[model samples]
Target chain A: MLPAHLRMLARLGNGEVTMQVDGPVTQRSILDALEAQYPMLRGTIRDHVTKQRRPFVRFFACEEDLSHEPPDAPLPEAVLSGTEPFMIVGAMAGG
Target chain B: MPGVRVLVGTRKGAFVLTSDSGRKQWEVSGPHFAGWEIYHMKGSPVAPNRLYVSQSSGWFGQLIQRSDDGGATWEPVGNAFVYDGVPGTHQWYDGTQHPWEFKRVWHIEPSLTDPDVVYAGAEDAALFRSDDGGLTWQELSGLRRHTTGPSWQPGAGGMCLHTIKLDASDPNRIFVAISAAGAFRTEDGGETWRPINRGLRSQGIPDEDAEVGHCVHSIAMHPARPDVLFMQKHWDVMRSDNAGELWHEVSGNLPSDFGFPIAVHAHEPNTVYVVPIKSDSEHFPPEGKLRVYRSRTGGDEWEALTTGLPQQDCYVNVLRDAMAVDSLDSCGIYFVTTGGQVYASPDGGDTWSAIVRDLPAVLSVEVQTLP
Candidate 1:
């Protein structure tokens, strides 16, 4: 079990969805929880085999772009402490 | 034949080019969608008069404009496909919250089997399909719906779907390349897709499975032999004969392996073409030389074609969709670089000539024969 007030930002199709997560989450745990909640989000975040980040999905916490951070890397203390929001943004471009 | 019509899509607008007798004289048309950025312009193969342009207006939103009168006038597909977001929800992508928000449509390809069916690859790593020409669209969420765990992270370009290749022989069999996810294939149309990144190479993975994150920029299939495919990967050029089941690097002979576009001669399936560029460190044409290489033996041997190109230092970046080979018997190979120059090789890349220069950054070029 985790804290009840931790918020997450899941960006999709040029829009962001901020949802509440109840746990101490690493990149892997956050995505696992997301997939369990929204089954449609299964393969949307990482590579199927290597479990590495896809080119388009970016994660951020407290103004920091955590996209390239390690999968199991610990989230910011503020994000874990339920004091700040973690954002997942979609990076869109025409070219 | 009157001449070849070149549809040029740019960062700003769309342009049309009509040539005279010897392919010497060219009349260039409008920067249609003037202030907007046109990422893709696809002329309907089934209907010569129909043209589709995908544009993104900074702070104005993204749109798919259709032109029935060639490149003269345009109209949007309506409000149905607009990104409105959930009602009353002040989400980040909420159009009402961020009034100027829109997703960029990076690539668009009309269905070979169904002319009205059009598919678009977006920056969000999602696929949108339009059944009635370019009127309305529906997101194919299946590609984003199957990841079971957390390892699925988006790469540098975001989780984007850059290229979509549908089999002309079997429209149901489709292939899509994601920037970091490698390549995916689907036999049952868009109902389901499977990652086919077995033999490619990526940056983060171990040497044994480096093929996973190879960052596939573009892929070309031998029209006659669908199983034979060529990929312009981030670090190397590779070929897969078993329809991506396995891949082997064939970029040894080229001066550099870092490039974006790859095209196979329409008539001669064994023949393919690639514009090589210096690696990430240099990131330019090899030794300041602008050349196109043709591999007639399926990457076994390559010949540099520079008949009428600049003889001196030439440093230009040719985008993936900027270079294409026509489907004619003799075949016409064309390429546009970031330097606003267009080159055409009518002799199957054996000889080259400049078609036009001093235009906007050439994002994409498609050649169509006019009746």
Candidate 2:
């Protein structure tokens, strides 16, 4: 799942997008695959140079906040197994 | 019939306003990129149908959008703005050295003769150029690497290179202005730059007459006479007679000299426009009157244009990039205010009317006179 704005930018019709990761399902691998599939989303979710998640962006999988997890850490088994969708969220700030 | 298309960048999104040569009725189509902040959008002079936009957000970062068929459709282009070599540091607000970081694009200037070449002025005070339209960008590091770079500090706003003026007469020359850093001129394209702030004086800085410490709010030049330039500094309205080699005060007879945007008449190089605010501390108009000061003699003497403009209880401010001029026979002038009103003066500055009464506090406005 992606934020409405990012989904609109990437021209995704559905809120949730499924991508094929070549290797183990980690945050870095999923993000790398996402960027490769949607070039327009580059630097939107993470910094181009630092690859750090933007301050106002969060990641969630299996109903748990995974934004603070290491980029290379493995995602939840539910997310890897496609039972649960990985979510990229725009934080609840700004009126 | 010839027509005009007004590109408006506001706090929330961008709006494109079109009107026939009569300049009476307008068709407003907008709120594109609905939730993002559109800093600036401008059409190319050579190819009026081609447009470039700086769409950014605090959460998602910067993105460049280009339109090949006017404002009908847009595609995201290059957003990466990596500085050249080792990005150095500049003086922060507290006088401590702060490392340079890419913030956002504040302005975009398309090539005068080519639709694909463009320039972007960015926050943290850097210039980037793209030759293949907006797909790729490369920093023109000469301006930020000046000898006085370390001493350059941000104004109340972050250190933003918010103005870029291309000389139509001489492609080799380009001018850019940064708040609290004064103005600079580049004669050898963007490879090298020199401070062109000779006669400017800013009391806020340690040296009132330093070469590169004056806070230049905005700068304007008439393409027919590129050597002559006009500036709206933090506190004074100024004019440069010889391509910014030197400048002098032209704030005579105005109720207040402090202003934001400055623009020149499309046909009359001698006519200039400025919207004076009360002071740097208070950005509203003087006496709650939203009037545009016009100087027919190129400055030193100004007249208050208030017909159709609010004269009482108005406190909205005009931003540095919110005023622009069109080259139609009547020479239309347009400006947007923080109160979310976009005003148009179809016949010079003699009269005015609001194109749109309510917008999201316009950030910038650009006009294209189409054939």
Candidate 3:
């Protein structure tokens, strides 16, 4: 889903593409970096005016849900180590 | 070589169909912003290559797109449409007060003289204008803040301001139409407004002919004769000769006037067009026929133009913004369906041909005649 959104930002379709976002890289910093690089994705994850996280979009890191957590909260070490992509997943509803 | 480019906005994406001056063969490109809803796309009348498209989606909200090289490439512009001051409230579906909300851009009309100046009509019924292309938009709040604002109610389509007509004869005069709220006109650009639904009759409403709430589907005025106007109301085809101060039923002999997208002939001020659906309950053509009725004498008499169009077993609905006219040596009429077929009539509305089929259920259609 992150790749799909990155593609929406016109940043994909290149071979061995690797995007680097510098510094502390908390959940909030990482998202801010991503949105900074892909301005079109600004409102796709949050709102344009309100900056509120869309109800259907969720965030996760270190095998834990961090969607409702504060923006400045630190992520688990595995995410920052590049072992897993701090996941941005679409929340599922209605079985 | 002179040619025509047909810009189509649909539920799933945007498309550009091109043809030479002959209006015969066609080359189609796109599904740009694929999987997104392209409510409307129109090219600058003066700078024909400059184009503006309203791209939106439920997952991503709204995004305005601009293209400088025709439709070859596009870049995202500003999508922020903040209403001026306290947005206030309108009549809700359950007859309660509901705050005005921004849904999406329904129509984009570029200025006739400038490429960067454009107007956008939005849902929850508001008008916005952008001078620096579509990067940033500011609401022309005088229309929304009018004294009658509270009483305005949403039609089945959620109270969208879908039509914006700038008076070519008078720069300060602008007209806009909102569903379930009738039509409004402003003489001082967009600072002040007045409702222009004097003679419309909607049998479904409580008072039938209230000052507002008429559900005006679309309105059209030939630039040569701006005083004389044509409208496709929710239930009747109407015409007014005195700048919308009053209107009279011109449904005349139309099989059914419960249709959208009324247009005027490019060359003939008195000639008009309307696609008559069966009724409010049945949006498709009458007796399953896809015929565009042309009224050469303005409004009264009508004749069905079906050449090359599906005559039977056809049931596609044309939206208010899905029809347009291209100014060429011979006027051309184009209209698309909810079923994804774009039909063209090079000789006005006498005959029709499907330029492209199985598109993404077109939401709007606009044409630019390239010189």
DockQ leader? 2
Candidate 1 chain B: 10-residue stretch with minimal lDDT: B86-95
Name the better of 1 and 2 by DockQ: 2
Q: Per-residue alpha-carbon lDDT of model 2 for B1-371, expressed as tens digits?
A: 89999999999999999999888899999999998999999999999999999999988999999999999999999999999989899999887999999989999999998999999999989999999999999999999999999989888888999999999989989999998898999999999999999999887677767988889999999999999999999989999999999999999999999989999999999999999999868899999999999999999999999999999999999999999999999999999998999999999989999999999989999999999
Candidates arranged by DockQ, highest first: 2, 3, 1
The runs of at least 3 residues in candidate 2 whose Cα sits more than 4 Å from the true structure, single-residue gaps closed, are none
TM-score of the candidate numbered 2?
0.99
Model 1, range A1-95, lDDT digits (tens) per residue? 11111111122443434445556568788777765664433333554334565565577888888888887888888877677766655556334
Q: Which ten residues in a row have the lowest lDDT in candidate 3 chain B?
A: B55-64
DockQ for candidate 1, please give it: 0.02
Taking the tens digit of each residue's C-alpha lDDT, what string does model 3 give over A1-95?
A: 27353365555563112356577767668877877766777776777666777777788766778899877777777777777667777566322
Show pairs that collide, candidate 3: none
The runs of at least 3 residues in candidate 1 whose Cα sits more than 4 Å from the true structure, single-residue gaps closed, are: A1-95, B20-22, B78-102, B148-156, B210-212
Highest lDDT against the true fold, candidate: 2
DockQ of each: 0.02, 0.86, 0.40
Q: In candidate 1, what are the lDDT values of residues B1-371, reduced to their tens digit? A: 64577888776677887674356677889777665667778877777667787776443345677777777776565213322232121112222322212247878887765667889887655677899987667767666554511234345555457788888788788888876657878888887887777777665566657433447888999667989889998778899998788888888688778788899987888888999988775656887889888899889588888888775788778887887776555678888887878888777888888777777787888777666
Please, what is the whole-model Cα lDDT of each candidate in the order they appear?
Answer: 0.70, 0.94, 0.87
